[model samples]
Target: MICFFLFTGCEQVSKSIKDTFQPKVDTIAVEKQQIPDPVPYDAAVERQIEDAQRLVETVLEKHTKAHVQYIEGKNTDFLTNEKKLNRAEEALKKLPQYLGKEIFIYSSIHFYNEGKIRVMLQHPQNPEYIDNYVYENETWSDPEQLSVKDNIRSRLISLQKISFTNVAKAASVYNEKIKQIEGAEPITGIYISVWDNNLRWSPASINGSRERYSIELNQNGTLKKFERE
Candidate 1:
């Protein structure tokens, strides 16, 4: 009877151990099954993202450092501060567009001028759309919309010289003018384009119901004309 009780007790303990360990084995198997395959990394896509991140960081650093300089009394020019603020705001506007977007280099064209290149980029998951970006003197301009037939490389080479800030200023002026018009919403984005020897600025409101307005800037960045459409 003693041996019988001892054997029964041992059997119960063994069963308990098995019961405790069985679930763990099952859980490990399930976890192994749930493991996902590694995603393939694309070097071109990675390079594009890194470039955009670097651009954002560079702009932010410029803004922050300018303020730091002012606070430390290294510079006292109020106009400079104002200009910096405007540039910073412009740069900040671009930040949201790049967030959560996949960017890839679509194409690149070298200009006759040394150190100048027109780079086309595909971004925002829209395979049909491409953007034109100008790179010169180690600086990159904000992207402009590029259509398949734009021939941006030749256009850039022939277009009259104009500062990007001038284009931005013209857009800002139009934005303010639109705000005073009845039923017009705030301008959320402005795209610059050169066609037919004319510089065009299109500012559209974030509100879907509002229509985009077009403004023409002269070669010198003067507001030549504007129209609602």
Candidate 2:
């Protein structure tokens, strides 16, 4: 027994009708998005080397720890002419053309060891890079960088010491003696090591036809010992 004329009854009935006929809206839950942080900068990538140039030059001039090796029956014209080999020479000849006026420091200069590749890291003005000059098909390719080793960091050397000049001189001084041995293959390798301010160079034949000899020189470049091994 409800009366439609009553306000409450009319309002309730209207609400009921609306609920029956009205369209429903659905709600969905959303998740918040998160963005990752970028990688940190490495200071070692730009770390500069120090405290070796002058000392290295002095060492080079001494020829104490330097080595000069000739391949079996190979020409050594490049050593005698003192042709463009050092960083300064490279800077003067190739860098100005390839890298402009910015100077490139040598990050990988060392004594000429046997079986070592003689390539320069070509990333101009950046010693931190590990890429070396690559030549192929009579054309020079661009440098490619690699991960620098943790233990063996870059060691700076002199710019003007004509790469392996002292070594060549040392070789010449001992070449006469090494070649003097009768009926033996010519020296195929020269190894020089310095210790206690003394220099010892061993010119090895390694061909089994001749014995290897170790020759030591004083700091003043005088012969100290010569022994057959």
Candidate 3:
């Protein structure tokens, strides 16, 4: 009788162990979070435009330094220290937003007399876009990018005759105007003026020899004019 009791107790213990070892099912609820919208290409385009402005400034700086050395017949520390100038040129070449296939890059001073300076990358497919650094007001998709042309002409016509400040001011104005047009609330349309002075070259003296001038813009950053001495 005691053996029978022992066997019965063992069977009961085995059943309890099996029940305890069984896996339990679990149910979990996870809340998903919503992601924010991505930045638009228009914003990227705007950023590119701003970058172009800075690049243009850098190009002017390099050109001016190189010009001064060439004019004075001085050994170009700039030419020897070609890292910065070369990088600046490369950056300009990459700036399609500003300098498109229609435009060409040339040595700023000698470019005037010399016709069609050599371009780094040409649009072989498009014969019209032969010059990668030159921009005609008549040709480009965005005329504002060609603001540098008028700016150059103005500097050339100045009584003082093509001072660094003149070029810088024009660059600043063009940049400011572009920013302004971009900032226009509704952006009905964008207009950039490249007016001609048609003034004869005369030897005029400037009071100060400052190489750059400040251009103040309206609401959107269009250049109103310069802060003259």
Candidate 4:
């Protein structure tokens, strides 16, 4: 009987050791089976991509010429001046590859005073791609890779509002003071110009003369400088 008991205890200890040392086999092979194979490149898609690239390049060249003409003071028609830019934007938007992509082309004439403009094309979905060009001094700069900020137009509108409001308030006070003087005119309107990230407001008087008020506004629409002429 003692031998049998010892034998039973040894058997239980061996079972426990084996259980502890045994490697667990994963029963769920679904994940391994679900791994997808790499997608093969399609010739049709490659052809489309090549066509789109050529279209974009052509549009960019045309846009550069139009901008150069404007900066050289040869084209004063606002609609004619923006025709190439509009065409470029339309062509880019129509590209199938650009669909559902965070692709944008932003053109701004206010970046420089000599009628110069900057065009920035960004594909945030593909960080490796960017095309930025500046047209100044009758030439287009080399393409540059630069990150484009979102909501640029909205920010500019906000800055314009802040600049106009401050200038209008100052002009009102000046008008009131001049009203006490004989035959003095009040400010009738304000024109806002944006250059070098600064807002300039020119207050127009009833007599047709104007004085400029230069202001700098922060990104959050706070006033950095409020100088009135």
Highest lDDT model number:
1
- lDDT of all predictions, in order shown? 0.46, 0.42, 0.32, 0.44
Worst 10 residues of 1 by lDDT: 108-117
- Candidate 3 lDDT over 70-132, as tens digits, reads 233222222222343334344444565544443322212212111111122223243223122
Model 3 misplaced regions, further than 4 Å: 1-42, 54-64, 69-229
lDDT, ranked from best to worst: 1, 4, 2, 3
Clash count per candidate: 0, 0, 8, 0
Native-referenced Cα lDDT, model 3: 0.32
Per-residue CA lDDT of model 1 for 15-114, tens digit only, reads 9999887744677778889999879999776875565455434423423322322233322222223354344334423545565544444432212112
Ranking by TM-score: 2, 1, 4, 3
Candidate 4: Cα lDDT at 136:
51
Give the TM-score of each candidate: 0.32, 0.39, 0.21, 0.26
By summed lDDT, which 10 consecutive residues of candidate 4 come out lowest?
155-164
Candidate 4 residue runs with Cα over 4 Å from true position: 1-73, 79-85, 95-100, 104-117, 134-143, 146-211, 215-229
Q: How well does model 2 score by local distance difference test? A: 0.42
Candidate 2 C-alpha error for residue 140, in Å: 7.2
Off by over 4 Å in 2: 1-76, 83-93, 97-117, 134-144, 161-164, 187-210, 216-226
